[model samples]
Target: MSEKSSDTSGRPESSPESGDGAEAAPGSTPAAVSGAARVSPGRANAAATKPARASTAPVPPQDTGPDVPKVPAYLQTQPRPDVWLGKGPQPPGLLSRLRTPSPPAIGPATLWSVFATALLSALLLGDGLGPNLLIVAVPAALGAFFAARSAGRVLRPWTAVWAVGGMALLAVPALREAGWPVFLAVVSALALGSLALHGSRSWPGVLLGSLGLFPSVAGGVRWGWRGVRDRAGDSRGRVRTVVRSAAVAAVLLIVFGTLFASADAAFADLLGRLTPDVSVGDSPWRLFLFVLGAAGALAAAYSAAAPVRWDGITVRPGKARNRAEWAVPLIVLDLLFAAFIALQLVVLLGGYDKVREETGLLPAEYARQGFWQLLWATVLTLLVIALALRWAPRGGPRDRTLVRSVLGTLCVLTLVVVASALRRMDLYVDAFGLTRLRISVAAVELWLGVVLVLIIAAGVLGARMLPRAIAASAAIGVLAFGLLSPDGLIAEQNVARYDRDKRIDIEYLESLSADAVPALDTLPEPLRSCALEHFRRDLARQDTPWYASSWGEVRARDILERTPVQNHGSDCYGLGQEADERGGDEEEHSYDPY
Candidate 1:
């Protein structure tokens, strides 16, 4: 009871005094508050002896619980508690980092990488890497690597190293055979590396590459739809823009298709007319046509479709702008230009004459002839442009006044034909190998040229549905000219050969012309006799097999006879030196550098 009374009395002594009473007398110091209680043990008993103050002061609040942990001021509101638990680095938030983009940790030496790729491609292209692994594969592999690496910046160095190494490794088998197992292992590694390192912050490259691939896979599926709508005159929204674009595309298709059809027809006729005839070599023009049909359809479809959506995959929209849209058409024009020129050179350079000599046998020729063709096509195209300004029909106002478009397209086609005719004329007078009959043939060739020009003018000027009208006309031209070939009617045939081991088999040859019989007596027995008889028959006109024209001819035969066989008697051979030696992957077969 006494202790309880003292405890209560002590509160009065510890309380702060206000007035000049006995408890508030001089010499008393205010007690210090410690921790949370605000009353120390030292001041409590002294406070008990004094009287309480009369003023109504509120009682102080007590904080009696055990100490609780406190976060530091700097980290008080941080989102991750674990960040505070450990001293290691933490990734920044997604949104915050993107707002302020940063440069690389180490500035890239992009030029050095480009130089390395180029240097390596050149080495592989020079036959520094031999047979078994071909020079053509370099571009394909390099292209794939470039395309894959364009997806992400992070894998640039890794991709560069692998691309270079893979190219170098491809030459290993050529330098010295590593057998099939090793080849398979290397190929597998290439595929895996391609998949793993493919990354990109910018989606523009990927989108374009995919679009480029689509036309090849889908064929004319999309083109057929667009062609229909294009003819319907449904121009709305950007109406003028729509009409102008469709007109340009249609004109190009018409011009190229007609020129190509005419050339094909003329060449077939030239081959047929050659007396003491020879078999013609393989025509890359045919393969090019197939590729064109496919690529054209795709390009047409892409042009018709609205631009692709660019949302999650990119940081910006329209980064590449409409460049691809414009670029594809120009590229198509250039490719067609090249094809047109090549067909011309084939006619002038005695492709028909060679076919007569090698009839019923594959004639060996590469599209290296494309260079000369490209040159002639350019020259003739300029001439045709000048002529079209004087002759093309005026466009109606609803057609967007596309007089330039129509004229330009017509000019390009005319130039290809005119240039082809000139090339044929030059061949007739060449003292190195001319006959009087060849001169007569040249006169016929001139008349045919005039007819072709007339047909082309009619097709362009008369047609309302330009692209399809031109396509149907081209198909008609091919069948018609093909039937009138000078070699007489084409027939199925075969070439008999005695292999190195002295076994004989009838190797199938595609087609033969009836006029080729006179050339058979010139060759050595077996191969000579076989080649002679085949030549006499003109068996080189079939269009089915892709490589048929290149088989068993002088260049191919000589190279094959000299080349060391691999994969146990396979017919694969090395491609000649490449155009640019410095831009491809060397190791993989399907690599593409562009």
Candidate 2:
């Protein structure tokens, strides 16, 4: 072969007939020879000797045309090993995830269940909450259950328990007339039920799942629309045919029915009564209720069918600190708590007389003075303990012993504070009869005591289940509070206080809901009549439909019906006229001392 001519840059120039100064092999082209020249001799010999192994490394695309510029190495995209192995693409960002395709279609039974729930909600909830809430909630829960089953998901025992709890909460509006308890119970029930359905075991997971409800509802709507869109193509002809048939039937019925009604006055009257007054004004509200019900039901079913693995979320442990750094502050806190507990003990033991003399406050006033402060202090102590545990030294036995000793002491002392706060509430209640705020706060303080106890117990038993235990305790507390009927209990306590001191606030009694009727009706004569007057007037003027009738209202009406107000003409102890003149601004005489 002739030597190739050298160019000005000292590189070998190509020949017209053959490239790279070499004759093309029998079956190979000049491009092949050039490519071969680019390979190293060692790699070529190795490739010739060994069988080719597939590479996970990405191959750059071949140049398609001479006009195309070569891409830089850094700019070229490379497939990851996972992608090359067909595992799937890497996780995308939030916006990318949101833009992903809709989930697969739900089962026909689940779809119909959603529709039925929506219809029932529109019919029952249009008037407001009552036994009708229970009616709607039961079918919605059952739909979730069946959806889970059909999707091959196993329902944990806790799921059923939470579902039942939610149903009981839904029945609160039907059982109790107090709006606050009903609202709180309903919200707690939804959170608990959502957590249970999603199988969230961690405290953070529970929080995230509860917060995810709105997103889940939106997803449900999207899923429903996608399913409808997918089935529309197949069902279009059938739908059109049905619509035409219905239109024809409606027109024929209208003509013949009108003629028959004109022929008979009784038939016309019956027809008019049977036909519902479907006004345009009410249509929007009914539609809103329907959509709300359908969306909620669909979300529950979708979540149960393919629950997210909220429990799988891992939280990074906080960086460990020196044993002294973690222990010193907690030890100081424990000492402070101890000092407070000692003070409480002294007061409990006979120092009350000295305190009363020095403070110049009545027993109730002294009790109320520091109750809120102690409650907050107890709450802050729990927070300190949690933080201390998080950063506690992960060293040897000495570190663990120090952590347990300091944190356990704090918890014990905080329990004393909780007790003090509760004692103060009790004294205050005795001084000024029980009110909703007092009872509610007292219940919270009681729950805090229980939590402190749980924390102490967790020191002995591993604290793996502490978060869930605390959540369950709170849920159970709320359910029990709702079931106990705080208004009725407040009424009873106030009535008992009146019997003891012969001093009652009739105005306060009148402000209570219908749930307190039975308790208030036990009062003697004019007092009973005055207390029941408001409830009696309300019940008499009210015309609640059966769907919106609560058991609390029914019971109150029955009590008032059996025992009419004896002294209607009496000025309700002169409080009624004052209330009207003040425009219900009787806050100055309110029983809530706090």
Candidate 3:
């Protein structure tokens, strides 16, 4: 509370009145002025800075209940205006008032950057499916993070870290085609998490994120209705001259334009070119999808950029927490997992041969046998741990110690299972070569381990949202693997193996998406041509424009151009193309986006 007033000489001055809040009255303080400069009477700009007067009307003090906590002045929420006037965050030029009837919801600079990215995204999508879409996700994700930052919410340090990883994951198209639902789930979790706080799981924020799907639709309809109602009720208001002038101009243009077009063939051609190519009778679903996508994208982008207040949505901590109730299940689960780990250790050390003998399977089959089961077990184990963490009791005598020990033990056992799953997957891939399923499982397993480590941290960190952070980080970390081009990576590794030791499975390689196109550069002869042929056929079918070109798309396009058409027949797929009847399958299975 400070005070300032003008002296007889018309220079502004601050009085030594304390706690009266006579600080240049109120809102008329020079916005750019700071520190002692604002009250400097002798300053040249002092005359321009008109002091605001306090309103004569009194504001009643708000009643906070006795139990309600006093918020710190700095932490106290501010009243946000529905609209902002004045030059905004721009240089006040001569035409500022005329040009800016209302500024964009976000600032112009932010909007321009976002618009550029969105346009790039639209152009890429026009070219059909490829790394172009994945690549576009980067700018979108970055834009979202920037938006969140600008929204001015106080964020946890780790939130930014995991968000970056999540954004990287969304760019990888290969993760989508991964056989398991795990990859998609991970991506979705990370995306939603970028919007949610680990603190409360922000159920209201979650609800709001869902609202982003149709924010423009709902907001526009509501706002439009209000505007119409206001206009109808306002008795003293004149019909807006600008609107009337536009109507008159439109009428004149229609009449004169039609008469001119009717009179001249050249004018008719010019009118035809000038007219917009609008579809009057578009399909309902197509229009619906387009609107939904546009609105959802905009809403999501806005929400990300300028987050709403979420403190109201936070979960209240419970007082009568039963630590033993939480500890029992965790201890029991850890014991069960610990025993299983013991059995796994035995199997790893020579006992695997005995189990194989009983199963009557070959060495490769033996290694494959437990891999999927172990992978599934590891996934389920993490789910259990997450649930336990979510439901864990708070603030009991020795509760932290007991819960931490139990959760840590369970995590350790889970890591062991993750390790076993990876070992088995490695053995299987080595024996039978790579497939989408195997590679995806290995990735899932690796991520499961990462999640477990984060889980261990959650137990140790003892923060409220640590479980959520664990889940978020796990999802983000594994999906981030997609950025490495899992399909292309697998293709390259397998191709190199084939070239080195003649261990190629051309059928499997041919089944991969266009992501593998560039990696086929070193593959020998017929198989390479066959794969290129399929990719080329796919390219010919695509409508990929120049703007959205990706490395995979461009490489595949180049390879087909360079390779002789004669070498690209069924002969490259060899006798297996005949035996498996995969010729038709390749046509169906090629890189066609849904």
Model 1 segments beyond 4 Å from truth? Answer: 1-39, 43-527, 530-594
lDDT of 2 by residue, 202-289 (tens): 7676677654455577777777777667767778986688669989999999999999999999999888655433467899988998
Question: Model 2 misses residue 304 by how many Å?
Answer: 1.2
Q: What is the lDDT of residue 430 in candidate 3?
A: 52
Locate the minimum summed-lDDT window of 10 residues in model 3: 95-104
Could you tell me how far off, in angstroms, the CA of residue 369 lies in candidate 3 after the best superposition? 2.6
lDDT of each: 0.35, 0.74, 0.55
lDDT of 3 by residue, 1-594 (tens): 123333424444433331112445466557422332323334434433545455455533323456667799999889776575653577654222212132124433344344445555443444344455455555555544554455554556655654555455545442333323335644464455444422224444444432332433343234323434555466324446545877999999999999999999999987765453234453454355344433434444454543343334555543444877767777777788888788767555544366466556544566767887888888888778657756767666576677687878878888888887777666566545566667776877787788778768756765556545655655555556555666777788777656554555566677776668778766666666765666667678875444344455666667767765345454564543343343234332222111
Which residue window of length 10 is worst by lDDT in model 2? 1-10
| TM-score for each predicted model, relative to the true structure | 0.23, 0.76, 0.57
Model 2 clashing residue pairs (backbone): none
Instruction: Using TM-score, give the best candidate's number.
Output: 2
- 240 Cα displacement, candidate 1 (Å): 67
Q: Model 3, 592: alpha-carbon shift in Å?
A: 25
